[model samples]
Target: MTEGPDITFVLGTRPEIIKLAPVIRECEDRSLTRSIIHTGQHYDESLDLVFFDQLALPEPTHHLEVGSSTHGRQTGEMIIRIEEILRRERPDTLLVQGDTNSVLAGAIAASKLDIDLGHVEAGLRSDDRTMPEETNRVLTDHASDYLFAPTEQSRARLRSERIPDERIYVTGNTIVDAVEQNRTLAAQRSAVLAEYDLVPGRYCLLTAHRAETIDDEQRFGDLLTGVGRVASHLEREVVYPIHPRAAKSLEAFDLDVPDGIRIVEPQNYLDFLSLEDAASLVLTDSGGVQEEACILGVPSVTLRESTERPETIDVGANRLVGTDPAAIVEGADEMIDRDGEWTNPFGNGTAATQILDTITGAERREVSPK
Candidate 1:
């Protein structure tokens, strides 16, 4: 069974790699020739290269060193680079994951060049246009040829936007696949628990990198104080993997990180998986972390006012506590003390195979679109 070289996956950040790794393995198993292109969006060695190595994904066929820039500038630069790569690779379909500048850029390049675009983690919407990710998701959705929605809610969102229902497939969620697979491996091999001097359920996992929270000095100060407040109130250690931008913002604002809140550099995907698995509760402004925590059945308090993945809240898997110290303290206290049992509204962890099956079937049908 010889499959054609028909897909090129676009990955830039650690989250994209985590969610896409299973799909890449599935493609390899089915012998569907695939190429991966890395846009150096998050170019740090620890964050980017470590994921490729740890996940055992093939070294990217191409790397477009489009480092950090303004949304318009970064995406615009990626469009040019991706278009160049598309010309050289000439794959039948271009695959992108999540809603990032990279995803938007890849979609725009692929669609304009008449290459079929497959968007994994589609149909997610926070309805907060002020956030760049919302804009990326909307633009990428309309441009994609195949939309792999992670849940029923995402599918409903696509239909409302007039995207053809026929083009959408509820392929569970690829992130859950990553979570399930990695947790198993990490449980067996991770020493992070010992290194951090932690006991299970005794600490909170914290990550906040969103511009909305960090870009505002007052809000950022509240976040630091709020996490400190939670740690102080609960007498729990708060393990934070500080994003580079977030660390700089802290220094810029002259906000002193208090004791008992352990601030370390950003972790690679594996370290994060292990850390999250061991946490009593999770706190973040990340969309992906919200779902990851929910699937792991760890209660999560989102620092944002709203989330694109409303299913988390719907299933009581997560809550939005915003940036207020009092609210964060209260939310953390309640979630930490509660019993952990919430139905994962995301999926049962078989998303990657389903996505590939649907895509392969679609490729066959295109021969006779009737």
Candidate 2:
């Protein structure tokens, strides 16, 4: 057994943790030598620590403690800190998921250190460079030695960018794996529905945390107005588990959340899964929420003009209804009336196994040369 450190998984934010939980479990199940590095991008105990317990994941081996800052400052700080950890640990391969600044920094640091880097959820592009995540996705995909695409469309996007075919593998998304693995647990353990007095398939779930949407005062106000209208029209409360950042922006901008929108604190993975699973419709500016809603067979209304997860839209499970109040209401009505029979295009919950197999196989090929 060639055994120093074989692989290091780097992530930050709740979505990264939730999506990566299954992969970490797979590593544990196989007794693979693996380490986790948490960047601390989301330092809130509710958003960060609660998830580790909810998902039953072990504590991260390295905590960078890189709290929030300007985009450039935060990404720069993470690159410096992660590079130091990579140097000290000298793992054979570094793995990063999604397009957060943490992923960008990990990709950059590993590339500079000449370490083999694997990017999970690679090749997703919204084609809108204005979104910070879009830039991160494109840059990390180019920097990565192994690109684990989540779908055939994502792979096609990479080929169009001329990423070498040998470097790309269409591993189904791990979000499906996470959802499938946790749905039953969520139903058994979560009291969110009862706490909120919500009936299954009767309310709309809302999440709006994207920087572009929340940072603009006009856009934020419009989104609130639109969602409020939808709620009034449907005569059902929109249960919004507000992101900390969005909450801050709301207060900073002096915007009042409209009536008919019930705002609550952020939720742990299992609790949030319960909300997503039970909602008749989901409205959000979050990519992960859009994907989850699709996998759960709930119709979703995306509050953005474009989405990297177009697979959801293609399968008729999601609709893009920007921030306009009228569009939001119309889209919500349309989605709510639609049948929830769209087949999930993500996968059959085996993405983590395939990802681990690919990573270990690549490590073996690398060790054979030495």
Best by lDDT: 2
Per-residue lDDT, model 2, residue 86, is 90
Quote model 1's TM-score: 0.96
Candidate 2: tens digits of C-alpha lDDT, residues 1-370: 2443488999999999999998889888888788999999987879886799879999999998898999999999999999999999898889999999999999999988868888999989998999999999999999888888999999999999988887888889999999999999999999999998999988999999998999999999999999999999999899999989899999999998889999998888889999999998899999999999999989999999899999999999999989999999999989998787998888888889888777777423332210
Question: Could you tell me the lDDT of residue 29 within candidate 1?
Answer: 82
Structural RMSD, model 2? 2.3
lDDT of 1 by residue, 117-140 (tens): 889989999888898899998999
- Using all chains and alpha carbons, the TM-scores for the candidates as numbered come to 0.96, 0.96
* CA deviation > 4 Å runs, candidate 2: 1-5, 362-370
lDDT of each: 0.86, 0.90
lDDT of 1: 0.86
What is residue 72's positional error in candidate 1, in angstroms?
A: 1.7
